[model samples]
Structure formats: C-alpha cells, structure tokens
Target: MGNGVKAEIIAVGTELLLGQISNTNAQWISEKLALHGVNIFHHSVIGDNYDRLTSLFSLAQDRSDLVIVTGGLGPTDDDLTREAASEILKKPIFEDQETMRNIESYYEQNGQSMSPNNRKQARIFEGADILKNDVGMAPGMAVQKDETLWIFLPGVPREMKAIMEQSGFPYIQNTFPNQSPIFSRMLRFIGIGESQLEHELRDLISAQQNPTIAPLASNGEVAIRLTAKAESETKAKELVQATEQQIYERVGDFVYGYDEDSIEETVFKLLKEKNLSISAAESLTGGQFVERLVTLEGASSVCNGGVVCYAKSVKENLLEVPKLIISHYGTVSEACAVSMAVNVAKKLESKIGISFTGVAGPDEVEGQSAGTVYIGLYVDGESPFAKRFYINGDRDMVRTRAVKKGYELLYHHLKQKNY
Candidate 1:
C-alpha cells in the first residue's frame, strides 16, 4: 500500500448497538492512529453474536491493511472476539503462560482462587504477538493473516488504553516504519453556517493536497480540520499553518477560537483582556449563559453574577425592568430586553450587561412563536441595544442556541471594540 496503512476500527459489544454505551473506543483509536499517519477509513460496531462478528471480520480483512477490534475480551460467555478471530483466520487459540501467571497472581493478591473461565483472558492466536496489559487481567494480542494485520484489545477503557500505549503503538511503528506521522488542527468558527463556510473555501478544498481540509458542523458551530503529514511535526505544522492563513484571509471575522475554545470561554477571555466585568438577566435561558461563564477559571474576576427572572414580576421588581416597557411591548420584546440589560448592569454595578428574553417552548407566548428570542447588550459608556432571532428547535435546543448566540454577540462586539 505504498508504505501507507489503511486501518479499520471495529467495536464488539451488544451494549454499543443498543445505545446503552457509546462507541468511544473507536473514536479514541482513530485519533491515535491518525497521529501515527495511519489512515482510518471505516468504523463498525457489532454485537456479541459470533456469526455477525466473524462476518464483519472477514469483510474487514479483505478491505483493510490493519484491523483493530476493541471489547469482547472478558472471561464471560458473551465475550466472543477471540473466538471469531480464530474462526475467521483459521488459527488455533492457545493460552499464553505469562498472562495466565499474571491473572493467577492477581487473584492470589486479592485472597481468592482463580476460576477456570478466567483462563479465557489469556488466550492468544497462534503465531501472534502478546500485548501485555499492566492495568488489567486481559492481555491484548496481534496477528498478521495474509496481507491484513488484526489486533484485539479489551473493551474496558483503562485496560485498552494501557495496552495500546505500552505495546500496540510500538508494534505499529515497527511494522510501518516508513509511514509519516500526521498533525491536525481544528479551527472553530461562529456566526456562520457549514454550507456557507464550505462555499467560502471551495477553491482551497477542491485543490487540497498534503494538508487536507475538512468542514464539520455541530451544536450551532462550524469547524475546519486541517491535517498534514510529514517526516517531522514542524513541517506538517508549517503546511497546515499556510492553509490556515489563507482561510483566515477570507473568513477570519467569523472564526472565534481554535481547537477546544468554546464561545463562553472566548467571551470570558475577551472580558478579561478588556478589564471589564459582566452580569446577565436571563429569562427563557434560565441563567445558562451566566452558568457557563462562572465555570471558567478566574471567573470571579469578570462575572458579576446574574438574575434568572423567568416571571414578569421578577423582571419588573427584582431586576427593575421598566413596568411600562414590559406592559407596552410585552416581556419577550426588544424594549423589555434592553431595559433588563441596562437595569441588571446598574443593579449589579458591572461594566457590561447582557440579557436573554425568549419564547423557548412547544407553544407561543404573547403572540410570539416558539424560538422567538431577543438578546440585549449594554456596555458601559455605550448605547444599549437588542437583537431579535428566530431560532429553531425544542425547548432545550432553543435555550441552548439562545445562550450560544448571546456569547456570539458579545464576542463580535468585544472584537469590534478591540478592547
């Protein structure tokens, strides 16, 4: 395969298929393989059924150069990964004495006798390398059948990670010595849709090579993942940075933060940089905006607290939102939002104030449809204003998007002021 390995991760568990547990192992394995420059092309989740497991194993062997299977390695009858592998590859399964000794030693230390079934944890395919597990009883194993290499690891996250780190990665490096490592960076953006972001970078995506560009959307935000492969990390980074600079030249304004920087964290950082503090008056969002801000480190320095004024009386009395404005334009209106923002800032003695008032529901409020939201912002020495948005989703989704949009608005304003 020209020194490149095409890998597939197969997670074996009925719980995963039933949605009782997430297939997080596959995600973890894929990320690790990427660092080794292994191209992971497929991920499959199969139940404990022996026939289905063997069928999937046959298909993976035919298509992939390296196949990694996680889970189904326990001592229970339902654990069928090793059996399926043996059947598919026609290899005899034998117990490794080193692993059996370790398992027996563990039971001895626990003041108990080892059970007969526990020997299953020590089983390995003929002519395979035994991957020692320092964290658990099950020892992982790897075998090469024809052109395909198959690896079996425990389903338990702790044990699987230990084996992979200790033996799995080393074996892979030895096998694929000529493969170049990969480096990737995620550029996160707000105030833009996925299709629009893709359209803006169409040329770069179409002519992509070396460092490839991928657009992903999740939870009201879009991200571009730039991946590059090179002999050294520095060279890969340089390639990715060159592409990143070009993307910024076109859509930098919408780009908020890189990697794991959330909108709330971005806003908090801006507030810290500007030496400003903020308080919120939350309605339909129920203090969610302020909750996120307060969770960050050093939040006490910039967060002045907030008021969850869900009731109109609390808005008029607690936050001192003007009763006349609420009566004239309704509580879910721009006038009320502006009044709440300005008054909350005055009451809390903060340098900046933000407010959320919305109809987040399965029903309408005051002739306004569900998802009707008004976000108000008041910065000290600046005019207070409110923006209306028609968000779409259920109650929880509407509230979530409303909070995200609030952070987005604050981010843009702080960015524009350059404070």
Candidate 2:
C-alpha cells in the first residue's frame, strides 16, 4: 500500500480556458480522490496544444505519483491527449479489438452509422490497463511510466464519474490499501454571513487536526464542511459528527439544513410535518419564491398558490394593498409587504403566507437604492411582520437573496412555534 499518493489533475480543452464550459471535472475528481485518501497537489488546465500538454504531463510526472487527465479523447482533430501521452510514455497507440467491438455495438444499437473517425476512440497506449467506459464511447486508460501512474478519463462528466466509480475506485483501493479516506459533511446555514460563521468557530478552526472545517459561501447561504480522515468510513463520520456537534452547540440557530438540503426542501418538509399549507406574494423577486417551493415533489400538498405582484396595481388590486399605501410607501415598504402576505394567505386559504418586495435594480426605484429588500410573513391567527434588508450585488443577486431570506425567516418562525 502506498503511504502518500500525490495526484495531479490536468484538464485539457480550449473551451475551458475560453469560459465556454466550466472545468467541473477537476473539482469532481478531486473530491472523489479525497474520499480514497489520495492527496491532489496541483491542478492544471491546458489547451489542446500538443506541446503544452506534453510539458504539463512531464511536469506532473516529475512531482506527482498519480496524474489524472481529462478531455481531448474524442474523435475530433483537436483531441491531442492520446498523441501527447504516446510521446511522453514512448509507447505507440494500438487499437484494442474488444473496445472497437464495443464502439461498433454502441453505434449499431443506437441505430446510427459509425463514422470512420470513431475508430480513433478504441486506441489504447501500449501495455496500459484499459478502464472500460460503459456510459460513453471513449475507453479510459491507466498506464505506469517511470515511477508515476497516469490515468486518462473522458471529458464528459457522466462517463468520467461512472468509469471512476466502477473501475478506478477498485484500482485505487488496491494501490493504497492502508491509506485512510477523507469523509466530509457540510452544514448548510442561512440568515448567517460567512464571516460570522467562521468567527463562531474560530477556536475550532485554529485548533483542528484530524477533522478540518472549511466555510463556503454562495449568493444567499453559507456552509461549513467538516472533513475527517480515518481508516474506515464510519470512524471518519464519527469524527466529523463530533466536530459538528460542537459547531451546533454554538451557532446552530442559523443552520437550516445539512448537505444537499436546500432551504425550499427544508421549508416543505417542515410545512408537511406541521400539516400546513403556504402561499406567497412576490414583487421584485417575481414568482421565484413560490417557484422554488413547488419544484419539489409532493409540494402541492403544502403549497397552496402564489401571486407575482410585480406592478403597483397588482399589489394594490390583487393583493388588496391599499392604493394609498403603495402611493405613500411605493410598494417596496414594510406595510406593502405585510399587506401582500396577509392578503395572499387569506385569498389562498393557506395556513401561512410569505411575501417579497424589493428593489432589484441597476437603477434606483422610487428613490430607493438597489438591493433594498423587505420580507413579510404571516401565519394563521398570528400578527404579521416584515424584515428589511439592504443586500449587496446585482439585480439577480438581490432577488435570489430575497427569496432565500423569505424561506429562512419562515423556517425560523415555524421552529419557534414548534410546528
């Protein structure tokens, strides 16, 4: 078993450099490799230029024990990975008969004519182990050159993930039998800024050893990823959970969900549990707040209906916000938001109502600056209230934050009511 297997990722494609597509393959591969305890020392993105690829491959071989390359394995002229690898390994590319048969079968089964250039997908480097691609045409390869191991994968994310999971994982397990894997869990929090979350966990972050805490922030949310390394998955999770408990004891109030749990998901789950139904009235956020809720499965049971009161007339006429109020407060006020929330709940006969009214703008509206947002909430038989916020960013950012904030407030309110 290798004690320390340092891996380097080289993503090849001019599209990645031109921002035509994101280089998500590197990020995904890095996370997958971390699970098996392989440390990634570097990541590089190069164009389809043969010289540049060859140079990067050679550099990776010099410093890294394992080199993983993605892209440039297609049948097109610009797919230079195979040619570059051939030059570096001093090995000729040969057609693998079985791989060729698979490619032919794929085309035949799909009722498509196979192009002559498609035969290029079956070529493999000399003396290399073939990584079967069940999901795609190009077969991946693993070769040992000098002291380093080189792995080449397809650029398509689905094919790469499938090949790595089915074939690559077993190979890694065999190569690094004694290495401990890294396990991570992310705690998702809303209504909290990244800086504040980090500050609350400052002591834990500084004194970390086995389990490490990393805080990540997006448009309207923050997440703390707790990663722990251990021999077994169970042990690693236990370490992460212990660290998570300490975090929860401190700043858990702001936490709404765990890894992969969206605020809408949490809201729906809680509403369903409480046997409640919801509706929303939105202005600057448009229908985004309700759209998020209804996207989830079985959301109809908890989601009554919604109205996008984007215009002042809609807010005054549809949601019953008085014309005088819109004239005075300009539809972006707390009074307007409260009226929308209360009227939407009454009109839809829902147990709860949420509203978003804001200025998501490049230019000021009604003399109000951009990013001025107000969220209103009304639960059945409860007094309605509104919260105002001056969010920062562009129009889309303001709208997104406004929607998320509405969900966060509702979630907190539900929790407080023990519903």
Candidate 3:
C-alpha cells in the first residue's frame, strides 16, 4: 500500500563519517524497504551532533513520508538520535519504567553495576511506539509526526536485525498490506570479467524497466541481480526468471550457480551427480580449494581429499611429479600442473583430479611474475588439461582466484559432458 511513499535513511555515527565503519545499516534497511515496494530517495550519514541531526531529520520529514534511522542508540552522550528526535518533535524524552527495569536487570544478571549512563537507553521519545530490543540493552522506537513515520533502530547489526525481524518487519507488512513486494535473484558467474559480461548483455540492461538487471563484480566473480516488483511473489519470480532467460541466451555458459551458490558448492553438486570422486594437488593455493569443498555437508561422498604440496621436494616425493618435468617446466608450468593432477588422481584412486601450481608472490618465481597460475584437470581415461591464468592482485587474491579458476574449469568440463 505504501508503494509511492518515499523513504530516507539516516545513519548516525562519527565512525561512519571517519571511515572507521561502513554505513551498512542504510544499505540493509533500504533493501528491506524496497522489497516491500518502498521507495528510498536519499541516504544520509550524520555525525553525533544534535543540531545537525535535528536539521537532517527535519529535512527528511519535509520530503519523505518514511524516515528510518540507525545508530546513536548506545548508553553514551554521543548517542544523540533520541535527543534530536525530541527536539524536532517538540517532545521530552520520557523513561519507560519496564524498559529501565529490564536494563537494570541485564546488568544484575551479568554481575556488573548498572552505570548511570545505562539508564539513558531506557528513555524514549514521548508518545512514541516502543520496540523492545530482545538482543541488546537499548530498545528501539517508532514515532509518527505530521504525516511522516520515523523508525529508530540500534546501530549494532545484530540487535538491529533482531528487532526488525521481530517487530519492525511485521509492523511494516501489516501497515502496507497492498504493497507489491520486490523480489530479487542473483546469477553468479566465474571465468568472466565484468566488462565483458556487461558488454554481452548490454541490450538487456539498457532496455530494462519493470524487472531491472544490474551487474556487480567482486574479487574473482561477477553477479547479475534481477529485481522485480509484482502484486504477488509468484508473479515477481516469473518476471525475474523471464529476464534471466534472455540474459542466459547470450552468456549462460559462464554462469556457475544462482543466488547464494558458491563455486565449490556447484563443483561438489556436479561431482555427486556424476558419481565421480575427486582429489586435489596444490602449490600456491595451499589446501584452500579442497578445504572449501569439505565444508559442505555431503563433500565426503565425492571428495577423496587433497594434499598441499607446497615445497618442491614434496611435489617430487608426495605427489610424485617427475624431477625432469619440474625442472623443465620450473614447477609453474602447465606440464607440471598436469603431472601433479594425474599423479594425485592415481595416488588417491579418484575418478577425477585437480591441481593448482602458481606463483603467488611479492616477487617473481622461477623467472615468472607473480599471479601466474595454472590449473589442471584430469578425468579417468581421458587426456589431462591445464588452464593458465595471470591474475591481478596481492598474494591472497592470486591464491583465491586460482581456487575459483580450478572450480570453473571442473564445472565447465562436467557441463560439457552433460553431467
């Protein structure tokens, strides 16, 4: 029902302004509000100053019907959100007796003294609707003034989430029953750059309207989030899926999973479906590749295990890479990676094997530059193949990219074979 009502989020903290912390509260609240067809017009981050916050609040009330604020709800003088609201609304901060007793009891249960400052958390804007904080000491509040709704929440992510999920979400849902909820789905892709992927889907992105397509990139992967607003959840999902199909016609091969699926999870699912057991041999990526796989519940069924053959001697003695091959390829070549994968598969008696050998460094290795990576995949009774990559980033980034590349290679291989 609140589809056309505009909303503004104000994050109150000096830490946000100083760059010591991010204004994630605004991002999270905006997302939640948008899902219920609420329009967010502005995001503001203000320091712990009474005059400035009051002015910002008044500005928000002038233009927006919904004002959501986070932070400055702590038991300290710098926490000025309540004071600012009181001043702007011409109201006094009143103590809710039950809330004060609850605050005092919290300290008692923790074997600590309730400092006088702790009582400040119990004070609320006069006549405001109180939102009990189940997870923290400071409670939240919602107040209405002059056709605008003001939602005040704690700054802590944990407490804020709890209060919103417990009370705020229900309150909004009940108040705006006719809203066409926005639904979003994310399609994740690996082995592709953001620029290239967006270029391929440029037409779909440019012509988007009801269901909008937005491309985002982070670390070694790219994601496209499709958001659709419909009267019903089913209709919203259908709209998102229809747009997804259009994008898939162009760049579907690079998409490894949907929504929250990670590269490792996709690989694990493929291996299980193909009934193939897998092993790994590693160098620069250490045990990171296998370690991530094993975190999944059913990994033990398809994951035969892996070894971190970091040292040259270990590659020779443990994975049994031929001394001549290591010497000729200098341990970072496709030949060495293939040999490591082949030998590890045989050593572990797995149906499939993967290996990572790379130069992840601040300095060059074996005359090769840092971020030079090679990933090898060997299926039983088939020729082993290795992919080479030169990633850009620090040592950890190089290593992480190598792991993702390993999964991408395996996932594509399985897909090609109709697994």
Candidate 4:
C-alpha cells in the first residue's frame, strides 16, 4: 500500500484508563508503524471489560485496515483480548501446541509445576499465526478477518517491543510488500508564541498536502513537524527539506535548532565555540540557570560556576551587590540585577555574567507584581544591561519561562556576534 494503510492502536488495560499507568505502548507502536508508512489515525484505551473491548474491536474492523491491540494477553481471569477477538471474529479459540510446550519448558527449567490457568496464555484464534514471545509467557497473535488485519501483543513494554522487533514487523512487511515509508523532521523554534508562528505561516499550513505540516507547542517552545511519504527515503527527505526551507524563509529568526535540540544545549555549543567562560548569580531562579549549563559535557570549559542569592543579605555579602543599589532599587530591581551580574563576573573572572532576579510568586514584592522578572547580561567588551519582563503563569511557570527567556537572550547575543 502506498500511504493508504489506516491503523489504530488500542491499549487494553484498566490501569491505563485509571491513570495508574501511561499508554506508552500506543505511542511506541505508532512511531514504529509510521516508519512503514502506516497512517495511525486514532488511539484508544479500553478497560478490562469484554463487552466494551468487543465493541471497540467491531469499530476497528469497520474503520481501520489494521488493528493493533496491546494488553489483556495474560493468563489471569481478567485477561480478555483473546476471548474478545474470538467473539468479534466468530472464530473458536484453540491453544497452540508449540507455545504450550514453550510454557511448560520454561516452568520445568525453573523447577516449578505449571498451573492449569497458564494454558490460557497459549490460546489463540483459529487459523491465526502465532508470534512467539521470546521474552515473556504470552505469545502475540496475528489474525485477519474480512478487510481488517488484527495484531495482538503483550502490554509489558520490554516483551511488546521484543515481539514487535522479532516477528510483528516482519509479518507486516511480508503482508504489505509495496508499502511506502513515512519520514518526518522536527524544526524547533524559540522566542515565538505558537499562535504568532501559526499566523505567520497560515497559508502554508492551510494548503498542506503530502509532507504535511503540524505545529506543536511544549514547555515555552514550538516545533513544526513535517511528515512525508515516499517509496524511497531520499525522496521523502527531499520533500521534507523543501518544506523546511519555506518555513525558514518566513520565521527563520525564531528557529533555533532541529529535532531533539534543547535551548541549553544550543547555548552550551555556542559558548564552547566562542571560547567564552560565564558565571551566574541567581535570585528568583535559584541555581537552575547554572544547573542547566553544568549538566552538559565540557561545560567546565565555559561555566565558571554561580552564586544563588535568594536572600538579600547573601546578594550583599556573597555576590557583593552594592547595598546602596538594593536600598534604592530593592532586590528585584534592574539596578540590583545589574550589580549582581557585574559583581559575579568580576569575582569569578569570567568573560560573561548573567543574572536572574525576579518576583516569582502569588504575592507582589516591592510593589512589583508576581511574574515580574529582570535578566541581566554582561559581556567583557559590551555594556552590562538588564531587561525587565512580565510573564504570565504561576510561580513555577514564571521561573521556568524566565530561565527559557534567559537562554533565548543568550542565544541571540552569541548568534549576533557571528556576523
């Protein structure tokens, strides 16, 4: 099939519905299936109820070409995947002799007698192909009924992944020999709101087709995912790259990195490249700003360390923020922030110094409202400056966003020097 294969992932478990466990199986399966050009249109989670499971199976049969169900394949009384599949397909359930032998062999090796209920794990729909579970007890099954091809795998992540890698993928490839492959790329952007980014590319998004564009926002950053399907990987990449260039032509300034690139990582790379060392004095953000920097490898070369001056006395004594500035402008003032940045850099003898001082709270400080933030930056050759920002969120959101904005500012400053 060319991109015509429609797939749905059904995660069967009460724990998933109850939020005791996440439905990561569907996510993993969807990502794998996309590599084979299978379009995953829907995801569903059903509790261990037979009627509801059968109903979902019936719906999958009508709408999807492939239905992959994970969980409920155990030997316990609550295990109902095989029973529901049999009921939906009007087929009889029979135990596979090969799987039964493997189960008995496993228990024999462990010096324990196999329980009668354990036979339930070997049961499969009539005429179904068994996908051996090399890592677990219950064998996965693949059976076709009418137009729908159903694959049942274990819910345990390790076992599910093993079975898919060993047998499930091979089975799908052999069945659908002419399948196209789907390739996708994520272009990450910072300093741009999701709404504004969408508005800027409204026309490109509206007229999207193959190599579809989708914008996703997460943790103060936005990403554009471009997915393309082609018979060859090269062709798919070409389609994705062409679309990415169009996006860059519009809002290139905001785009920082590509897939899996974090702002901190980008900043660290830039610092290393410029042979620059930096120090920080954190007030409202605590040590989070420096904490992020030191996590990266080779950070010792660029990071000179930091001082967390949450208390006003510490800012005065340790960072030596001028008492006159704090008395006149308060601890959260731009003047105090500048002193903190300049003093920390001088004390640490670094080329650059950054400071975060703000009121992150449900209450105001020194007449400044909550979410009021000031970021101070000092480069050896450039003048020290502090920018005031009014963010919108709770205390935690404000702190997190403030840290991100600091990275954005640093990124722009370092990037500008390249020209």
Task: Report the poorest 10 consecutive residues by lDDT, candidate 3.
Answer: 169-178
Relative to the true structure, how large is the alpha-carbon lDDT of every model?
Answer: 0.92, 0.89, 0.89, 0.91
Best model number under TM-score:
2
**Pairs of residues clashing in candidate 4:** none
* Number of colliding residue pairs in model 4: 0
Flag clash pairs in model 3.
Answer: 1-178, 1-179
Q: Score candidate 4 by TM-score against the native.
A: 0.84
lDDT of 1 at 60: 94
**1-419 in candidate 3: lDDT tens per residue?**
34777888899999999999988888888877777788889999999998999899888888988788999988898999998888887778988899999998988898999879988899898888888898898898988888888889999998998999888878767655787778889999988899999899988889999799899998889999999988898999999999999888899899898987998898888889889999999889999999999999989999998989999999999998999998887899999999999999999999989999989999999998999999999999899989889999999999998898888888889988953
Please write out the lDDT profile of model 4 over residues 1-419, one tens digit for every residue: 33678889999999999999999999999878887788788899999999999999999999998889999999899999889888888889988899999999999989999999999998988989989999889989999889888899999999999999999988887777787877889999999999999999999999999799999998778999999988888899999999999999999999999988999999999999989999999999989999999999889999999999999999999998888999999999889988899999999999999999999989999999999999999999789999999998998999999999899999989998952
Question: Model 4 Cα RMSD, Å?
Answer: 3.8
**Which residue pairs clash in candidate 2?**
none
TM-score of each: 0.86, 0.94, 0.91, 0.84
What's the ranking of the predictions by lDDT, best on top? 1, 4, 2, 3
Clashing residue pairs in candidate 1 (N, C-alpha, C atoms within 3 angstroms) = none
In candidate 4, stretches whose alpha carbon ends up further than 4 angstroms from where it belongs are 74-76, 86-141, 144-147, 157-170, 294-301, 346-349
